[model samples]
Target chain A: MSRREAPLNRVVMALSLVATATWLALPLASVAPNRIVPGTAHTATDLLGWPLALLACLPLVALMALSRRLDRVRCHLALALVLLLLMALPGWLAIASQWLVDPELPQARLGIGAAWWLSLFWLSLMLIELRSRLALVGWRAALLPVVVATAWWLQGAWLGSLALGQELDGRRGDFLEAVVDHLLLVGGAVGASLVLGALIALAMRQSPRVERLGFAVLNFLQTIPSLALFGLLLAPLAWLAARFDWLSAIGVSGIGWAPAFLALLGYSLLPMVRNTHVALSEVDPGVLEAARGMGMGRGQVFRQVRLPLALPVVIEGVRITTVQAIGLTAVAALIGAGGLGSFIFQGLGQAAMDLVLLGALPILAMALVADALLGALARRLDHRRLASPGGAP
Target chain B: MSGRQVNAWAAPLLWLSLLLLLALGGDWLEPLLRWSEPDARRVLYPQADLLTLLVRHVQVVAIASGLAVVIGVGAAILVTRPGGRDFLPLVAQFASMGQTFPPVAVLALAVPVLGFGTWPIIVALLLYGLLPIVRNTLAGLEGVDPAVQEAARGMGMGGAQRLWQVELPLAAPVILAGIRTSVTVNIATAALGATVGASNLGAPIIAGIVNNNTAYILQGALMIGLLALVVDSVFARLLPARQ
Candidate 1:
């Protein structure tokens, strides 16, 4: 190693410092005798004893120390330390449950406290900072979460007394159903918008007037709040269902998935149409000229050249629409559309925070996963386009 | 400011007046709303008047978006400066990633930590709204021509002065666009706050859902939709001239 001292990495240093502070200062876990009663908060010192609690701070201190002279090896070591801290978090909760809960009391539950959450949050931020510093991307950046998740899975049995687990235990079937409902709603809306958006984009391409008017209408629809759009659709659909037996038989009513689907479709169209139009139009004119000079007709040029080049941006629009629809579908639960959001509103109605977590955590995970997957897909498509022999560099 | 500017304001003013008229004089629309729900005993949301609910709704969004602008823009500025440059990558990544988290999920998650109330809604909105502002501000600030910045330095402008006089002014249009997106999204999200006991415009929609009253839902939907339109129109007007 060089004798010269490296500059301090203040970002990681600050993050570790906050993590250490919160770990020691705030409650790490809470113990409740039953689900109905509020829990008694426990700080790290009380829960793990002074020696063990202080021992837990060792990695954080090491992280801060390492930041003063960050090198390639030190950065890698710091990332490993961060991941170790994250994985151990669930194990800590498992230990808390074992020590605090009475096995005889089946109703007993252990709640995660502020410190645990803050520590987890700060550690994740540190991981991000380190990952970018190390220039890790794609699957390399995903390793921490995979490891942490595996650790949590290994500790899952011990966390039977955990509040979130208990909530899921009681409503496992409903949870599965809600996940399905949420996916179906999001998938249906995104799929429909892709087709409709393409046709609209194609139509707009034929005339300047259509382009202006189409965008104007979609923009107006996009401006309306999801809740209001859902509300407005209810009365009209109900009236239509009342007048048409087929519509009623087919599950088209005032509420439920009909209004929800319609509203999601409305929200999804703006991004879809805009992206499609831009993607289809923004192809290089030189490329089109080359295709035409190669004796290709208009139809062949469009299908073989323009469409392939446009696929990545169109996929990007799908990504945005899918993520947006996932959230709006949750709001659709308010109008009797069954999804994970039912758990949220029901939990809020009952003042059951764990149940809210049960609902929220999964939705959060879904959004993140969808975003990651679709983003990867788009990047891969763009890469393929650039790499193709005939494609633009 | 100018005749063209005044002319540009016409659409927003029209929408604003229409929103206010509906909020203040919703009772006059009862005869029309009654047709939607002929069997219901009460056709309007009776718990609170529409105008008051409208005010409260706007207040919640205003407070949330205001704080988001300050903190979001401030953090963006900080990370772009020499002292804070080390933090820029993390801040930028977080801002983009954070937007992927659904607004409803954020609100739901907040309820667990912050408990139920208007404040949780505000906090959620603030947190959710911060992303666009930070993202846009970073883009705006970074988008400034380095040559222009170099010239400013050549003219002996200090770091702070160059930022204030050169960078921010050049970035104002983009920053304003971010604020517009944040405020518009927050207005919609705040309506969902009613389900969490916030009692804003969304309260009527929640109530209407509970009672199976179409009239009440329509009223709430109309007012919230109109509110969104009015605000969006104002942003639309503001955006064109500067761009």
Candidate 2:
């Protein structure tokens, strides 16, 4: 807080510019016969490339000029423009894939090359910088353009004919179903873990033996590979379902969501339990004493004092657990649970990278959103904690 | 575990047994899993060599976790320095960003560029493993008592000497906790490798998924589960025993 100490925003700004410049001159797409075939690299200058690319960089140029100061609504505008332009680039490549094929090269496949993905990374970072520069206050402001852009993309404007879109169209129903299943699986697992993990933490707080035994079990459970956990559950679940008619009647089969759900629940427990324990333990003892001095009973003190104080950390645990669960559930597809991992394994089997992206991108977006929303909430909670009734802000 | 005095040799002995199992237990264990085919014949895994797969799995986890530790701890040390203090959030966010993409996704993306097999999985595991080590390293170093550090400084130690002789030793256990986490997580996540053609313990699971054979799944899952348990226990005992 003493001073800026150093000013290197310009360096980052310059690096962004340099990377984009490099990207513009490089091949952004490759036209191939199929997923595995090596496609010839097609550069940006080939079709509407330089002009479009330059327009995209206009905001970045403005950013570099005002690098010494982090302000400029125009720069934010330009970054959004750049993002839109970059998104369109892929569409154009998709179009070009259809139109630009040689007479002999039938079934031309258009796929993003190294430069395309790299530029996406760079522009995403630049977009972050612009958001920070604009002082956009929360996830809402940051998400506005992204939501708009994603909505626009969903219209099947240019990306529709792309290999990825075509795959989505083919299995539109299945894809939509998978999306719903993925959300439900994550929601259920995280929700259950929050309750179970907290109860475990509470037990740990009441007894040292419980704490010791709980962490050991949770850690061991966590370390088990996701697939292994699912696999391990198979025989027992099948046996239980067979031995008891009611269990089978309730749909506790060996595969699908049953094992997947249980595995994710187990995977999410360690973070949930660990965070709850640490948060509960770290509450200042003096605060508890003060509550007691004010005539609060043990239960009252815990409900009001301890729980409120520990809420932020508990939420943090939820955030980590949710994000981690989102990832782990993708692997749950192997057990016939049929989430995003189904698309991934299929894509891998088909040697179709775009199909993989189709599955992976949504999972990535989900995790990011979960992390962002919960992270912002945690920060707000900490800020509120600072402004607690008796605390100095 | 918190209150009991751990026998120093307990973990090592457990690991020795696990290693012996990994080396020799597969043939004996094969008979436990009986897969029924359409012809009504029972069999073992169609294409699995348990020892080979376990070794490959260990190799991938070791390399990936090692890289993650070096980078995570190195970045933590750098950012905690006066000159690098401002970068703490940036580095932390960057590492976090790497994790939001699932390891399976990373493998899928990496395969096209890095080619098939071990390299892609290693890259994916490295990315997946980075955040825990970095975060824990930050926690460990920051948790070092300031007054004790000041005392060390008062003894006329330079910055490097102070960090190496004082800060690091004090932070060692916590940093090890981070490595333990990164390693364990990567071991689990590295199973994504089998999906991408990197032969490992997941190979059987993937094959089982393909063939609808629970026996193959068990063979793979059992080995990985046991492997994870053994590795995890070693990490559990990493903290200095107090007896």
Candidate 3:
């Protein structure tokens, strides 16, 4: 390692630090009389008069400025500590918000400002950059969640500070319903898409012409903006529902979950079909010839030799489709499909950032979780394939 | 063009010509659609011409996707370099973050700060489009055969020479695939702009939804879907010919 490696995202870290400091020093949050009334803005010092906001940084800045010259493990550890501290800052802000609230103003609504968001963005940026260097493994990765949870737990002792929490608390039932609605929309679309997509793949495998047509159509369908696809489905769906009383009874209207489900299903088919096609076609010809030589009929060979080899890739397709569907389902809110997007659109309508976050955060979490879990599974399957003796069949 | 080339170009060409004709002759075509339903709303967004809307839509997509390609490809190159390798997962996560957030959410968040405009739409589209380009570029560049790279190195090529002459050319197809997916995806996503008050193909769809008129929606869907198909087909044409 003769070459000097550049520090990863140090520039981003510096900018983040600057932004966070500005967030703390400036009016950290705005306090409204209620959700409707805009209130006064106060920095932590102005509000709490104790600079508890700055206390979040003690873990970050405790190390001497000269610590940059320290050994690799030490410097890395310091950076990791900084990350852990930054994660706890939001919770500290929540605590400070509660601590600062006067008893007289019980209805005081705390709304997060741009500074708070910018600070969070930068902190995450710094964390992402620093995490790669930490070589976090085993219990190491668990440390972040534990610290972040601990911070939240400590802050929750006074519920007054958490604005977003209050927003959720006000409509806890609605929030949960929205969450369930989101899952249903995503679940319905993904389930329908998987079965339909597999059928399409199977049909495509019957002939080259089928494959070409299927791919081109699916690919083209994919290009149709989700909004447009929903639009296209609306007329036909409405007509079908109108023509058939049974369909209308089954909730097959032009809008809402029906069009949304159909549109999501349309968008999902390309990846699902493509993965399945690729997985199935990529099965070794030699293995197939051997299977046939071993007196395995077409059906038996397909069932025994082909399915196992293709299952992981098919699952990969499901993963991709599920993750994509999770995000796309948010758009279903536009047509009154009632998912997390309802909150997002409602937030937009009311210019409420918290409501938008309420919707957007969960979708983001769902996508990340799906991506990580599916990705790990895919990697595991690939590892098994690689580790097995000889080669892929 | 040769017979094979003409055959290759046929579908995209027809689609392209039809799109141009529709964009120019949308006013005339509105009457034809009305042949089936003369009473329904034929001209959904009477305020804006479909051509103007299509042009703006193209402009938004081209700009956003063009920028996405530059930033995505550049970031991919940077991270793949030995010095910047540590940042690869960060870049990947960031790009995927854009895709995972859902464009509507991004738009909803962006509108307050950015205000309503093509810029917010562009921001959403750009972020949404980044993943495929970055992901593909990384995969493509990494997929270059090490043996081929060694041979190039053995041939007395400098790092720059080897990369420009050998690696990039080899990776071009895969990178192109990523760009294709990104651009095509953005073409669809850019329609979200109508919600934020950017005049585009989505104007009619939003109008249709509001008015409960399917004709307007059909008109917009047709145009956008046609646009997506043509662009995707063009991308498919651009791929290096397989053996």
Candidate 4:
């Protein structure tokens, strides 16, 4: 197609142009003399000088220009440019740290500014757009984030003066513990809900009344806010703990993991049961009939046929519940349920922005990772079913 | 309206009145709440009255949800149009991706950039709330059968007319469902704002947590839960039928 006939990839172009504008206009980084003091913001032009700053805009401009007509070659080039921009982001932060933080003052910190963050965000979006446009899937699609993450990881030592880095440095042990707690809580909730949800879904399948009442209760439980649920559970659980010495000994208190787990499990069940029910019910009856025609027993058909077909959808439910649980688990921190959320609440209490970032970023990463991994697993199972002979088309 | 229609409205109205009654006359429940905290001088939240907190909570959620609907639906509409179609995939992807970022984390992140207070809470809620609205709007608009669009075109309806009259009306149910989810989520999230210094219904809960007072926590939880139920019931009634 001629350039005029070929539609411009407006998404990438718009993203790049906005990124370019923001990168110049907003502060690139802020520098504080010490941890307690507020930072002074410095724009790209202020740090790199006008010429160098304008020069730095080269990749974004190229992305915008290349998107004018996105043929395979130009699209590849644009994708490369996007990846290069992402990888360079950490390098830029390292450079900013070197320039802004005083070597003499170990207490000084370099904070990431609005422009750097906006550029990172917009560029990631551009990468997503390019990846979709290019039809990259599976591992090919996963390559970009992995590479960028590796680049950031390798440059961590150089970012010692970065505020987020400094905060993490101080709380390395706490950070790891928080991550572990966050994962355990999320896992415990999702796992318990999955097993319980399957039971409920199975019972619902057996009886219409159970189906109606089960759904009603789960839905009502879902409508209550997480915090309120946690708060509501506090009194009762505390009363129970007081009443039973064993319960307190076992850590079933009004606060902490007990209520948090209960609340998370409660919130998680609706999605899990709904998905499991739908997945089981929606399995093609013809396949089951065919299984029976082959002299397969009910247990055999369920294990070898129905369960495999339902697996993907059930996994999908798990994905949703897991992601939701990850988020809610953060709120559980308020009840002394130690997790990354404690860092968030603690950071907020102390007015420590970097400390908050220390908590928030990992939670964000955990959610995204859980979503991608579960999504890929579901798709793989689905693809396998479609590929297998006599599987649902 | 028919009796059934009145019945449909009754749940929300009852919840709303109960919510208002509780907020306005919480002092009446002081005797009841005192049972939870036998020794404390104050059983009711002492700093701000429940009514004021309830209003502020509603105000925050209203503003956030309102802005989310406008911007989100507008963006969804824009990307679905022929002129803006190139952005549809990216917009859709972004919306779903945005949902993965937890609300509390988003709230925490907002504090650094927007600083403390109601605006950060509002911004966090708005941004977080936008995801569902955008996603559902896109699904709703796109799910409007092409045949229907062609039919509208056959009847000589213009683009804008078809959108406002046919497409939007047809998509209203799904879009309304999205708004309902968005508003419900925001009500819960807005309560988290109390930690960051924006006093709403969450203030009492936070106060309760700090002072280790179950009465304060219960009062706050009650009001928030009631507010959520009232708003949710109204949305439930507004929705055409449960999916």
What's the candidate order when arranged by decreasing TM-score? 4, 1, 3, 2
Put down candidate 4 lDDT per residue, B1-243, tens digits, no spaces.
599899989998898887777776646778898998888778877534777788899999999999999999999999988899998888888888877778888888999988898988898788788888998898899999999999999999999999999999999999999999999878978888887889798888887777778888887877777888888888888885766
Give a tens-digit lDDT track for model 1, residues A178-205. Answer: 9999999999999999999999999999
**Cα lDDT for residue A7, candidate 1:** 84
User: Which residue pairs does candidate 3 place in steric collision?
Assistant: none
User: How does chain A of candidate 3 score by TM-score against the true chain A?
Assistant: 0.82
DockQ of each: 0.70, 0.49, 0.49, 0.71
Local distance difference test, per candidate?
0.89, 0.77, 0.76, 0.88
Q: In candidate 4, what are the lDDT values of residues A52-150, reduced to their tens digit?
A: 999999988888889898878899999999999999898888888888888999899999999999999999899989898889989988878899999
Give lDDT tens digits, candidate 2, residues A266-362: 9899999999999999989888888888888988888888887898999999999998898888888878899888898788778777788788888
In model 3, chain B matches the true chain B with a TM-score of 0.92
Range of the 10 consecutive residues with the lowest summed lDDT in candidate 2 chain B? B34-43
Docking quality level of the chain pair in candidate 3: medium
DockQ, structure candidate 1: 0.70
Clashes of each: 0, 0, 0, 0
Proportion of native contacts present in model 1: 0.70
Candidate 3, B41-147: lDDT as tens digits: 45534634788899999999999999999999999998888777756888887887777666777777787568777888998888889999999999988999999
In candidate 4, which residue pairs clash? none
The segments of candidate 3 whose C-alpha lies over 4 angstroms from its true place after superposition are A1-28, A36-55, A61-83, A99-103, A122-154, A287-304, A384-393, B1-14, B35-38, B143-170, B233-243
Q: Please compute the TM-score of chain B alone for each predicted structure, in the order given.
A: 0.93, 0.88, 0.92, 0.94
